[model samples]
Target: MSEWLSVCVAISLLLSLVTATAAYMLYSGLIAHINVLTGSPPIKKITFAYKFRQGLYRNCGQLFRESHNIGPKLPCIGVFYDDPNEVPGPQCRYVVGSILSEGEKDADKELQKRYEASGFQVFSFPEVTHVVTCWFPNRTFFSSLLGVRRVYPRLARYIKERRLCAHPFLEIYREGRIHFMGPLARQGDFYVPEVRRAERRLSEEDELHSDSDVSGVDSNSEYSSGSGVLLSDSRETSPADSWVHSPPQQDGGDRGSRRRSSGEVSFKELDWEQSGGQQQQQQQEGTEVEPRPEPSQKSPEAPTQEWWGVSGEE
Candidate 1:
């Protein structure tokens, strides 16, 4: 019985020693792997703040690429470290990847505050750490004036409130500008304008519209006319020269009759009519406009033809 007990004790001790050795080997292997992935050419500890900044930059770049629907162009994510003291550490310390539209971009605001709160010397330029990629589509308006016809009034108001010179999106991709921001962190080199020309136009148009609205006067109204001799003079003048652009004179009788309808025409409609008249005049001068090729075959016209809210063209 004593001999059997001694053999059992020896077996238990040997098993315990083997287990300890195996655990140590696994721990060492993990540490080495992490170091190799993140450690710079010369292995060293990068500052915590720097690492965080790099992480954020990587996050922003990934988001930008994803938004454009062009991923896989970049390999390792590049981050702009906020800490000047923190040198570049491991090349792979940052994760160059993004989750599929499952997170908020503003998630990093708290991170921004954390760094500012810590007070570290980041870099020479103002680090615009907030990550946003704005896009503006082109606008087409039938009558885009500073009056009731203006579309997107809220957007115009917002631009005024911000006092931005232009829409931030326009600055990045202006009409005819090439897109070149790419190549990992090199995309950071592109400076997107905070405001754009469109925003400025909006501000100006809004102010004009508001003033017109408040005075109960449309911009095209006679009351809104400036003190220009051409506008104020009532004397019948000769047809304007070819070089000069002017509203077409309504032919004598029927046109004179239409003058009573000062209240019915909208400001925008009138403006369009006046501008379009110039081209019409240019096309018709010295030659009678052969009546519009009467739509192939004349069909029955609507019994109640609504021409400018009136019965018919006399």
Candidate 2:
């Protein structure tokens, strides 16, 4: 009976050792894969004050959104060290990060500065698939063995909540220009709120000026059309008026010439009246009239020769 009990105990101990070794190997493999994929070392420490600052920025973003109808508050991730009790109060470090949307990535420099001043760190993953939080120290084999269970479940929960695909977090430690947080950390000399307001005012003023210009162009077009109609009317009446005002000159012994001239003048008057009536109809109907082609010099000379020939016959 004693021998059977010893064998059972040894078998149980062997199984336990094998399970622990397998877990440790799995944890190491995951860390190695993460490091290769992210191209950066994982952040293991961050300060509590840093997180406090992020909270303030998050509130600011919320308030700004409420007042301006701009954007929702940024989501953040907090990475905690395993043993908070071992670290000193101020020096205790942990990472705080926010995921940026596609649009927010190109936000104005001043706006980014405001966010940075509020104590938020920014990071962008080339292919962001999962949210990462450091629950265990990477250097410790035992901690990693225990942490994988909690870490993976939390990661899975985060992905489920956000409705994201299976993804891993890249470890980011410090601020850099290449990193998304770099832009936010940068400072600007100008006041962001005032500048934004001034830009809005300028835009409004430009819109008003453009509207006035469009109105002026419309009025000018109307005035031009009105003047054109008046000019056309005057042109149609001028020839008839000149003919009526002038008396035909009669030469002695030129009765045939006088008769021919009178006949030509009567024909011209009839033609003019018909043309004027057509123009009036067109104007009243608000339709454009095709312009009459001008008589060539040769045409006028032929008529003058006919008049001379009539005078010679007389």
Candidate 3:
């Protein structure tokens, strides 16, 4: 009988512990899910000490811990620069730090200097008219996780429904709440300098790759500015070569059209052709049409169908 009683007691204790843990989780989620607001948040600006990092955002908890250890009881802020759904986990960018000043309040210059001396960067969010704001309960350590899991989805939905261009999500842990903020205006102001530098580096790399790729093209051929016309690089001296006629890519494009060949058709208009090629432009149907002057009695020396002009005589 005593053995059975002990077994019952053990089972009861296990059930009680499970119930308590479940209850606590539900309570934490409930606390984090409240006070969901999406609009202009009541903040003009914020000054913060930050450490920029690039990688999975889920790993940002370590950053929070580090900031907290250095500046306990201080408000911490996280600026997330990429959507995990759109960007790769390893490529996500974020800056985490402690807030020294916000709005009209005086900054803790000593704390700012301390963080700066510790190799942390000092940065500020510019004043914005509107922002998406929400808060999650920070009653316990688990609250941060719950808040992130709960608030971010709803915040994303709200922004999508309203078509608000909120970006570079900001999370501020202060006063027992994890305040979520994203600017609807001046959204670019939130990106840290590190992010800009990284982006510039990426763009420069892309440009360099494009340059290398373009350099290996056909040695004799080159692409035109527009009109997608393939200009043949034929430079053989023919009877019609001297009277080179190349039309502008567009109807109202530059009146002077240079031939794709080497130093051929360099002149804007030949002596026999009207200035600016206005007469030929009206007769052309498509974008590119070489205009050739008709034979007339006034110029008996006019080149025939072969257009045997200066190059022909030579």
- The candidate scoring highest on lDDT is 3
Q: Tens digits of per-residue lDDT for model 1 on 1-314?
A: 99999999999999999888666544323122111011111101111121122222223333334322322221111121111112122211121121111122222344434544544212111222222121222121111111111111222333335332111110121232111111111112221121112223433554455454544443332211111001000111221111111121111110001111322335446665765686589677864544331111111111000000000010
TM-score of each predicted structure versus truth: 0.17, 0.21, 0.66
Q: Model 2's lDDT to the true fold?
A: 0.28
Sort every candidate by lDDT, greatest first. 3, 2, 1
lDDT comparing candidate 3 with the true structure: 0.53
Cα error of candidate 1 at position 28, Å: 6.3
| lDDT (tens digit, per residue) of candidate 3 on 16-62 | 99999988987666544455556677556888889988765556777
Show where candidate 2 strays beyond 4 Å. Answer: 28-50, 53-89, 92-314
TM-score of 3: 0.66
What are the candidates' C-alpha RMSDs? Answer: 29.3, 37.5, 21.5
Give the 10-residue window scoring lowest on summed lDDT in candidate 1: 303-312
Clashing pairs in 3: none
Model 3 C-alpha RMSD to native = 21.5
Better of 2 and 3 by lDDT: 3
Backbone clashes, candidate 2: 6
Q: Predictions ranked by TM-score, top down?
A: 3, 2, 1
